[model samples]
Target: MTAFEATRAWAEAQDAADPLRAFRDEFHIPAHAGADTLYFCGNSLGLQPKGVRAAIEAELSDWAELAVEAHFRGRLPWMHYHEYVRDAMAEVVGARPHEVVAMNSLGANLHLMMVSFYRPTAERSAILMEAGAFPTDRYALESQVRFHGFDPSRDLIELQPDGPGGTLSMTAIERAIAEHGHRVALILLPGVQYRTGQVFDLEAIVRLGHAQGCVVGFDLAHAVGNLPLALHDAGPDFAVWCTYKYLNAGPGAVAGAFVHERHARADLPRFAGWWGHDKSTRFQMGPHFSPTPGADGWQLSNPPILALAPLRASLNVFTRSGMARLVEKSRRLTAYLDWLIRTRLDDTLDIVTPDDPTQRGAQLSIRVRAGRDAGRSLFEHLERHGVIGDWREPDVIRLSPVPLYNRYADCFGAVEAIEAWVR
Candidate 1:
């Protein structure tokens, strides 16, 4: 039978047997023409968990009734609200409770991390990263270098792919480190690349950077909820991530930061704020800046409770689902998508995501080979046909089937839509 003819039956069978099938009901899937859209854009913005509304409403009710007393008397208690999700967030990122803190947005947290970790001297002043990192990371690294009185052009070392439609290789990365190891003060890279969906070897990079006397960190925006990370054991100097994508937190949700325990007590310099001050005596309005120990010390301001409640709701699902199980399903689902795209649409699409499952996450970035406008045309057609995937400028379509809410059937529907569109 043709690819289109067998696709639905196979997908339905897979969905029927999937262990994580129940998770699809936990999220609020968007509808188009009275049917659930094949929502596969979890790498960009996650579908809201059904529990989010009630979670936020509870906070709203507490505020309406308790007013200023909410700080002490609310159900979650505003003063310690950020602490409620600490362990859950830590569990998601494989960090020790003391080493992780849910805090400001991704960019702000990255800047804050640089204040403590990106120290540069005249002798060792270069920062290294893979070329085509997410734009914000590029900006943060460049600004941090410039802020330290170094020229970005000279101090920034970006490792580029050796061939067209390829990703940075570990050999190239290590070679760059060996070449500029002494001058590279900070080595910041993504846990999973934004456009190509390449999962870097964080542990290896950490070991290599430390051996070269460079501080290492990760912008884990794509990796946190999508991959299994052992941040504490992997031993990066620090890491930062946003919760909105795979975490199922709403748009502009509170982000998180991880600082290794080795630096927790170091007399490192940081940009401090009232909330980062010792919580026990914060209400006393002390003139001195005494930071809370561990990653909490990096927090700059009190977090917004409404923004955090959804993260709590999403984390509850993760606590139940377990990372190993989610990752197992993620691998299988992504592999299936890869297989379908190759067998059914290989003539029109090229998968830029790493072919090795171990080197990628849930996303598949497809480069449209049909024509210049073909990628956008197909992406829009998929949307019109109730398949939701995101488009990257020029010629790529990004689709991530989150194990938490996406099903084998959703994957089938997305490819079917693409097939229909191409025809």
Candidate 2:
């Protein structure tokens, strides 16, 4: 990588050279003061894909034309709507098609996965996860622990971070697992830590958790679309993610899950529904339940086609651009943002996301040097100036330059806004 220059010309040149630069037009960047805002909030809700409107309209047309028949009629029939997204989504997450399924919201899918994976024995009845996990994950885990007739205080092991910037060290994780191996029934962690933008070692975590007789899983809300994942090869028992972030899908888009091929045939206990029954025999309406093989078996209800339409459109963009290329661009884009922040705003900001590019996705969580009130003021200033990043409570301002749409010049513009505020 060349030394980053803190100039608009340098930023434009970088953008000119970006192979993924054209992808920026695929999204509908929000307006501020009659121009496109420098959108740095893809880590939260992604900007809507331009194709999303057409995708949903197509479904709406079919609904009007065919009514209930739209399920089997239409350009993308509702009967198999989830299938339309399965392959592209699998490629995005680096999993086998059968191992993945588009389904309910993140929290609902987490609970469903827990129902099957969090089987606790009397001897080994604890759940292990990183401390300060996303509140939804903590809530799901705590509820699961209680549902299993165990005390969450006794059974939930929240591993504290020992690394800089509150990042978890693999050493600390291994040590925690080693100490609690006997009591741990499941290990749930994030593919990327939401607050700090720290990327966890999924493969290593899976290996360690399995060694400790734990069923491993991940909440990839921050990882999916932001990071290139190999969920099947990484070998977690399962993983879940919402499509709303980094995917360019609309808000509250249908979520996805991965259940490894190893469990495709396992007789695990699950909360079953009509949608999960064997497809060939699904409409047979038999008394006995026979599950569809692989992750499809976990579906509690049919997919919501309207919510899934935008995902289909967004995944199509991903399919065309490719995850590997997007990630390549992501590393460079984030590095540029990191450089701009450190070099230009070092006096006013402190980056909490790791300096190592491999340890993070696109997000850089920055804290203000002047303290929380100052940070909030700076954040408001950025917002006022049309730099759309997000403020996580206390002091951090998260800026994620999504590769699919964010430009290097956007990064430059954002830092310039910060520098303007500093001046």
Top-TM-score structure, candidate number: 2
**Which of the numbered candidates is closest to the native, going by highest lDDT?**
2
lDDT (tens digit, per residue) of candidate 1 on 1-423? 213333678888888888889988999989999999888999999999999999999999999999989989998899999999999899989999999999889999999999998889999999998888889999989999988899999999989887436678888988999999999999999999888888899999999999999999999999999999999999999999999999999999999999999988888899999999888899899899998889999988888999999999999999999999999999988888888899888898999898899999999999889765888888889888988889876677899989998888888778888889887
Report model 1's TM-score to 2 decimal places. 0.97
For model 1, give the 10-residue run with minimal summed lDDT: 1-10
Compared with the true structure, all predictions reach lDDT values of 0.90, 0.92
Q: All candidates' TM-scores?
A: 0.97, 0.99
lDDT of 2 by residue, 19-132 (tens): 888988888888999999999999999988899999999999999999999998778879999999999999999999999999999999999999999999899999999998
**10 residues in a row with least lDDT, candidate 2:** 339-348
Tell me each candidate's RMSD, in Å, in order: 2.1, 0.9
